[model samples]
Target chain A: MKRILSIMGFVFAMGSITSLLIIGMDALTFERILANEQALFQSKVLDAFDVPYTTATINEVFIQNVEAIELDVNGETVTVYRDPKTGRISMEISGGGVWGPIIGVLTLEPDFVTIANVAILQQEETPGLGGRITEPAYLAKYIGVVFNPDVVVTKNIPSADNEVDAITGATGTSTRFQIILNDTHAKLFPLLQALEN
Target chain B: MNRFWKRLQYTKWFNISKDGIFKENPIVVAVLGICSALAVTNRVENAIAMGLAVMFVVTASSLVVSAIRNFIPSRVRMITYMVIISSFVILVQMFLEAFFPVIAASLGAYLGLIVTNCIVMGRAEAFAVKNPLKYTFFDGVANSLGYMWILIAVAFFREILAFGTLLNFRVMPDTWVNWTVMALAPGGFFVLALIIWGVREWAKYFDVAAE
Candidate 1:
């Protein structure tokens, strides 16, 4: 019993010291990590506006061209990025992938009906397969697509304005992405509409 | 103390350190921790990042574990080493996320998996627990370099064949077509096998010449 207690004490002390060290590391890097996440999201938002910014200039350009405001969409608070000149609105989206979470940012044209651009901010879709959803080639296909009936992912070649090609060998992820993109759009579009009126 | 330090530098310890890089290399010769070796070697940059992360964890964990060797109970020693190693892995993860966000993203779950890497646990159990701190430090360095060199070699061929690039910079002509399999898991296996064969043969020939 005494030996066990000593072993337990040693283990506890070691764990505590490790936790404290990790806490110190976390505290040191917390701000930079937060800034990095914000910068990534902001850049994706800016991509919708077709605005270019390097890592060094992301904040400056975000300040120059984007107005970020929070809105209550249903019971949830959503961040909305507005382009003052074009009246474009950008919103973030998140949903489940086959293996992990998928996140993206999308922007509507000034009219709020036409998609200006959609960029994936983060995703865990299979790389070279489902992961291609974030590829510029794939994301670019969504540009000029209409969101009225929600964007459709087609395995066949996309011809109609609302349809886009599905990633080859990743039909499940493609279909899941379609649902996430549409559902997020449906959920937020009405709330975004409330902002206009 | 001075004689011991001098002997530590110039004697059998030197060969022990050298052994990890070639004769008992963790990756090619001994083949410990092959999962990450196969997973991250598709890209040269990812391999470099993983190598560095492993080096940090192994070196730091070994040092701490060796320093505290006497205090740990024999039955709970594995658990203690794990805790120490994981703490370092978390530190590396946080540091990467803070400073090198892009690489961290590409590395994904593999970074966290460093805690389970056999090379680290093997060294902590087989070496660090019994060795002095100074020798344990050298062992960590040697073993990490052994692991790193093999990972880099596999990554080099895999990247060049799979993407026609090195570190994402295109070296092949614009008309060059890539081999997709090289970007996947099987390619890593084939590359690893060939490297092991080549390294073994070379080492064998060198040994025979010396004898």
Candidate 2:
């Protein structure tokens, strides 16, 4: 009994100390991490709305042009950014990619059916292959695109209202990304309509 | 007395440092931490960031593991080391996310995976647990340096071929066709293999010349 107690005590002591260290570290960086996340989210939102912002002026632009809100949809609380002037809304959205979740901000046009723009906030795809999804050249195709009916990503040249030229080497990411786009848009369009009404 | 001091510092500490950096380089020779070496070596900026992150994790974990060596039970020692190493890795991830979000994003899952990096665990088990704090510190620095240089070199060649750029600055001419394979997994494999071969050849020649 004494031997078991000693072992248990050792385990508890070690576990608690490790937990405290992690907690202390997390507490120290919590605020800064939150700010960084906010900055990245705002930058993506601005990009999606096609608002011009430099490193020095992004926060100002976001504050001036965007009103932010948090809402629950399908048991997930998502932050959405609205451009009060344009009535276009940007939402934090994510879906699975090849290795992990691909996270991004999506902004819709004033009509709420067409995509104004999109900018990828985070991804874990192959660095030089699927990772091109985050590159500007690929994302540029999303600007002012109409995604209603069905959004498509294809390897061939995009020639339709919902067509986007897939990244040359990243077919998997493009296909999965299309799925995410269609799903998120389908899920949110009605909720957005309810909010507008 | 001075000769003895020279042998202790130079023949000992200097050799340890040199071995880690060149002779028994962690990446090329030991080949212990190959996962991050390949994963993050696609870009020079990412390689540097990863190297620095590993250096911090290995050094901090080694320090703590060494400090607690005497008290930890032999059976639970591995688990304890893991806990220490992971704590440092999480701390690094948090710091990078807070201060260097660009790097944090680019690195992504690999940053959190640093806890699994064998270099930290290997050093703890082989050196830090048995050595005094000073020597353990030296060992940590040496191994990280070994790991850093190899990663940087791999990134250098890969970036130049893959993107025709180094550090994202255009270096290749407009007419240059980027070798598509150079930016992918095959490129990493090919480049790392070439490096290992080149290092072995150089060492062989150096040894022959000395003889």
Candidate 3:
């Protein structure tokens, strides 16, 4: 009876120690983990447009310059000044992707047809499939292509400036990419054109 | 304190290491942890991450089990192992999520499933409970490494054929006709079967790892 009691006491003591160790580790790492996630979000958004910023720098910029807001189904409106260095009014047009969603900040050079930058915010797609749409191979196709309001998934090249190839197995994802891009351009370009006056 | 020191000497480090890789080969003989083998083995990077996660969980759990072996009830041994294993598993998940969020997300539900892996429970019950503290630690490390190598073997074939890459390093040229079929889960079973066959042959040559 003494031996059994001793064994039980030993097990209970050890269990408490293990639990304490696990809880200690979790408490120590929790804050850094949350910060890393937020930093990742900013980096992905900036990468979509070809804007260069490290994780730390991205957080610094987003905290001061960017604003987050929810929108109805059409999309959210993000407005950035043309010269962030000097204030000039401009608008960001954003929308969804097929598998999940994406928000792009579309900016134009002085000429309405020319693109300054486009930063995509969110995407959740099948990796190596729909996910490849964000790669330079796909996104570069959109770089100089003029945004058309009536964009459709087309096999035949519309023309160099107007067409982009759909990702082979991920046509739905590409189609969503085009739709969001076109809607942003269609609504925002005219508004910017009016603002120019 | 003197009793603790004496107990530590009996753990038998050499036997613990040899047993994990040979006597109780987790994948070959025990046939445990096959789920991650199928899912993560599709890519070498994913395989490595899964292996590391398992290693961390296994080593941590074994140590905790050893440290607490005496108090656990014989009737509730499995429950005790589960609690210890799950704590480490959760810790692994949180670490992966914090540092390597992409890999963590890719692993998805399988990360949580590590707690239920039979090899971990087997080690705790068969060895850690009977052994001293230090030897149990080595057993956990060796078993996890052995399991990791098998996973890498499966990943090597699947990743090369499916994506024409090894651990995300480009190998096959762009024009190479990639095998889409290799990327699917069915390919993992095929690769695992081939590995098992190879291990059996090697074991036969050396007269090792028999039953």
DockQ scores for all the models shown?
0.77, 0.65, 0.32
lDDT of 2 by residue, A1-197 (tens): 87677667877888898889889989999998988878888888887666899877888999998887766787988667898878889987799999889998888887778888788877889877898888887787887678767689988888888888888888899999999998888888878888888
TM-score of chain B of 3: 0.88
Backbone clashes in model 1, listed as residue pairs:
none
Error of 1 at A60 (Å): 0.9
Candidate 2 Cα errors over 4 Å, as ranges: A1-5, A67-88, A95-100, A124-132, A135-137, A140-145, A152-160, A163-179, A187-197, B1-10, B172-175, B205-211
At residue A39, give the lDDT of candidate 1.
95
**What is the per-residue lDDT of model 2 for residues B1-211, given as tens digits with 9 covering 90 to 100?**
9888677766667777777777877777778889888888889999999999999998888988888788777778898899888888988998898888889987888999999999999999988898878878888999998899888999999999989999999999998799878777888888988887788676552334664
Candidate 1's displacement at residue B151, Å, is 1.4
* Each prediction's number of clashing residue pairs: 0, 0, 2
True-vs-predicted CA distance for residue A107, candidate 3, Å: 12
Model 2, A27: alpha-carbon shift in Å?
0.8
Full ranking by DockQ = 1, 2, 3
What lDDT tens digits, residue by residue, belong to model 3 across residues A101-192?
66545555555555545554356767668877656656655555555444455667656556767788887777777777677666566656
Please give the C-alpha DockQ score of model 2.
0.65
Clashes of 1: 0
